[model samples]
Target: MDTKRISYLYDRYQSNSLTALELEELGMLANSQEFDSHFEVVFNKIWEELKHEEVHKMGIEAEQAQVDFILSHPRPKTRRLKFIHKIVAAAAVLIVVFAAGLFYRSFQSAQTMQPAYAIVPGKQGATLTLASGKQIKLSDASKGKLANEAGIEIIKSADGSLIYQIKDAGTGTSGMFNTLTTAKGETYQVRLPDGTVVQLNADSKLSYATSLNAAGERRVELIGEGYFDVAKDKAHPFIVKTATQQIQVLGTHFNINAYADENVTRTTLLEGSVKVFSAGTQKMLVPGEQASTRENQLSISKADLESAVAWKNGEFVFTGQPIDEIMRLLSRWYNVEVEFKGPPTKEEFEGTAFKEKDITEVLELLELTGAVHFKIEGRKIIVTK
Candidate 1:
């Protein structure tokens, strides 16, 4: 009835490495209503971990085969087990079946011909362009003060974050400006001089004045996706400008996706309030609301805050998003090219992947959906139905 032992046995069973004694112990525990609560908690935890590790999805045919195998296997007869215990036992069997299916697919993959290619994931890196047009590759810069301009010190923190600290408040308001850009396969975080913090996604850019309030307003121009936690400054409202819209806030936490390739610009508010303006139209957004601008028109709706800011939290969350759009995101983060062999499928994907995983693992997870397959050649990924 020990939770840890139950978890260990479950894992071993999934991997097909459980010994006869352990299997018997797990089966006995599964038939007992005394540990029904423990079993439920462990079941949920294991399911989440499997999904997080990108091994939850499997082909329908393979899953059905595993289910058949499970049904044919002998089970100990139990008359006193409660209904809840029966459900728990059934759920545990399903988890083991899926895990077996995943293992079978992995073995099949390994038996196939191997390729000579690999693509890694993105990491923390950016290019900082000072007001004087001097570019600093932040990835190569040491952890210390990189530059001093107009009484503001630009330092790379020990954790690889870009920080702007004021050396002299009197001289902080210079007319100079700076820009931070992240190339493909890179992301970066910055603490601006005005105490605001921003996390830039891959293939993005942010331009702002060194003092942040030089133009009588704290404004920044964004070229791609970015998460902003604006510092509270009643005297100077924070403004974020994109190609299609501008967001104004006194202080708020929000995420903006305005990639040039994307058709619409989406701004999701997480805390406080923000006013989004585009083409003479504007909408005020409360927390958990999203404002989307397309073709000079603006609209508001409920927001999926977790999916909106997943990248900033080192995750890739997809909620019924098309494969093409998903490929676009992977292309940026993996610094690779994607080609469709023929007509693209209309299938959509719904799952969560860690941004830190390699491109191959993610592709394998997607392949489990059976809606698409992939072939990697050098840095290119070819998609096919």
Candidate 2:
């Protein structure tokens, strides 16, 4: 039967009015990726219809539910349509996994996964640009007052963290700004004037005013990824400004991934609450929720918190990422060049690897999956199918 016919049969099944013959016919389509995707859309609508809650988890449960309900057919003494193939039901039920598991499928295809040379991983160190334009290499700079900007003392702690203290509150200019930046293969941690701790990922920047505004708002602009543990100030809300979105919070722990190259800017909240807004959309996120902003629209969804914060805690949660997206992240964190011989691997991958491990070790894990192969030459990685 044509896809339209299959779709019609599936619709009837979803509405709880399908015959056993149609059920077997539709089950055969489960092995088809295109058909599965179509079924995913159909089941998403059914989940919404269920009205138990938003279809936040994987969408497979709905598919399995239909199968289970059909198998539990209770009408006795009724002439049942005999199925031609019993295996169809089992295969269809197994295919009912949700999108959350999209990138985590069992690997079906394999290739060599080796790299030419190892690249050093990024570490906790960044450069600080004071309001006076004086540069301090935070990695090499010793503890103590590194510089002063607008009356705020820029202190480099012995522990390699940067801090801004209002040494002479009445003497410093309140509106001046300072910037903290991490280069490729680097990271940084800093405390703002109000004691908010920020953890910056590789190739990121954070710019903020040295003092809170008189209007009672703590504002900072982010250009890459950063995790924020905001200090409580009910009277002064903390706002993280990105190019296309703004996240406002009273006191919360959140992570913002606002890389310029990414089409969607993501804000994942881990603690308390946060409000994300753009041109015409706004969303308030609770713990374990994430907001993705693209093209002036903001969408909310349940997030894999462990994956979202993995980098901040020194690991990479490689789940369902294609070769291209995977290389881009490695390029930033390891400061290396990457080229692909063919189209990037579209398969999803999973594993937890340390960020501090040699880049080769990380690539080894990817190779073990047989998803793709990597060859490095003079710091350049060539990806092959």
Candidate 3:
């Protein structure tokens, strides 16, 4: 492909102005050896634009959506570019997925035989509990308007995520509250009335008011893990309350891991500032900093932000985490039981993998690392050194 055409396509992809057919054409071009031969040019263009930050998270995510759509649908034709598009789509996915911390499968070495039974990956969905204590399964909810609660309109978008809009700001003060919960092997995203977006991972729950309270504090209680992109409202601090601490932010993006089974609760700030209050102490965190709390005691330190927000961004990022920790996460997403063959080993691994891929792929990757091996029998995964 000519640089002029490729450059234009890349610009359109970045700006998200590309038509459906144009995106397919771009995906096809990106999957081509000809395009691969000149990847340096486009790669450099992207790096030049987004060198200081993560390169095109929105754009890459859009590309991922396209690739996923293409894969799930039947092929159109067997043209040269079409065949190349299918083959290169995986390669193209690696580029963007790796940027977001998903382990690229192409880099793995030869794999040993996987388990007899393979486990499919998790999908995007959750359950919503209204103030009346009625439960609405998001998967069962159709597209468009789902409900009107406390003057807040709840809609399930075409992409399967939930959106909330305020029908009347005057009615926003209602005491009615709603909750979103994700069961094991499921994940979801929902926008709150204040425009804050929350992505819930497997086995997580977020409870928030139908609208802002009279106290001027937009607070939400979280159990398990979730990522937040808070809309700016300095007058009303967006407070994320967990079992261990309260993270107060004024329009920021962050990730919090508050799972009960974990030893400590972690809050990682990605952008903007957050004040963490716990254990009778308060500390402010900047971008790339994390607050870890156990009991009432809290500590501040630099953290792996990528790993922190990996689940929200659709990947499993292990930053030198122990095998036991890894299995705990896998257990939630795969909805399976994990058993150790013997004593726990002191091995750590640093890598990433797509959360929506087969569980066998991850186990086999670990197996290849000489760290551990795995066997599957029904819904149980046995790990051995």
Per-model CA lDDT versus the true structure: 0.80, 0.73, 0.76
Ranking by lDDT: 1, 3, 2
Per-residue lDDT over 207-290 for candidate 1, one digit per residue giving the tens place of the 0 to 100 score: 998878875679999999999999999889999999999999999899999999999899999999999998798889999999
lDDT of 3 by residue, 55-91 (tens): 4444655655675665465533221111112323434
Error of 3 at 114 (Å): 4.9
- lDDT agreement of model 1 with the native: 0.80
TM-score winner between 1 and 3, please give it.
1
- lDDT value for model 3: 0.76
Candidate 2: TM-score?
0.69
* Candidate 1 clashing pairs, residues 3+ apart or interchain: none
- Of candidate 2, the 10-residue stretch with the lowest lDDT total is 102-111
**Highest lDDT against the true fold, candidate:** 1
Residues 1-385 of candidate 2 have per-residue lDDT tens digits of 2656755875575465767676556555655667655656655555444434333245546656765664465423221121112333323433333332321221111112224444689887898887777788988888898887666778888788888787766665546678899998999999888889999999999998777553578899999999999999888899999998899998889999999988888899999999998867788899999998888788899988988998998888765666687788999899998999988866766556677877876774465444577777778888887
lDDT of 1 at 365: 62
TM-score of the candidate numbered 3?
Answer: 0.70
- Which residue ranges in model 3 land beyond 4 Å of their true spot? 1-117
For model 2, the superposed segments whose C-alpha errors exceed 4 Å read 1-118
- Model 3: residue 38 alpha-carbon error in angstroms: 36
